[model samples]
Target: MKRGFLEACVLAAISGEESYGYQIVKDVPASMGLTESTLYPLLKRLEKAGCITARSAEHNGRLRRYYRITDDGRARIEEFLAEWPSVREIYTYVEGAHHDAR
Candidate 1:
């Protein structure tokens, strides 16, 4: 679930415009615990899944890979949004159960 959430967040970050690794890290909320170590592999996975496309551009005389969301990636964001109600329902049930136990 966390992985899926991270993927959705990353996709949303780039959904607005093309973005590079460091920018993506900055775009996603710090509370999400996004780190350089976690982001690269996740970017590769998203690329592999065809949810995003990567291209290289020179910035400060060095290559920077930027990612843009693909059609599938947008669909993924929508899908995650659609699932929110169900997730919320489960959370509510769990919270109620925990209070009952207490």
Candidate 2:
């Protein structure tokens, strides 16, 4: 479940434009706890899933891999959005339970 959320976050980060690993880490909120160790593997998974496409380009005399969201990635974002209502309901239920426990 957390993996799905992280993937969605990464997808959304690049939804506006293509980005590299370092930039992606910067683009996502710090609160998300995104790190190089976590990001590279996630990027590979996203690429493997066809949710994004990667290309290498020269930057500062070095090759940088940039990722752009694909049609499937956009569809994924939409799918995640579609699930939000249910997630909200669950959150509401959980929050009520937490309050009751107080």
Each prediction's total of clashing residue pairs, residues at least 3 apart in sequence or on different chains, is 0, 0
Residues 1-102 of candidate 2 have per-residue lDDT tens digits of: 777788899999999999999999998888788998999999998899999999999999999999999999999999999998999999999999999999
Best by TM-score: 1
> Which portions of model 2 miss their true places by more than 4 Å?
none
What TM-score fits each model? 0.96, 0.95
lDDT per residue, candidate 1, 1-102, as tens digits? 788889999999999999999999999999899998999999999999899999999999999999999999999999999999999999999999999999
Give me the candidate number with maximum lDDT.
Answer: 1
Model 1 weakest 10-residue run by lDDT: 1-10
lDDT of all the models against the reference?
0.95, 0.94
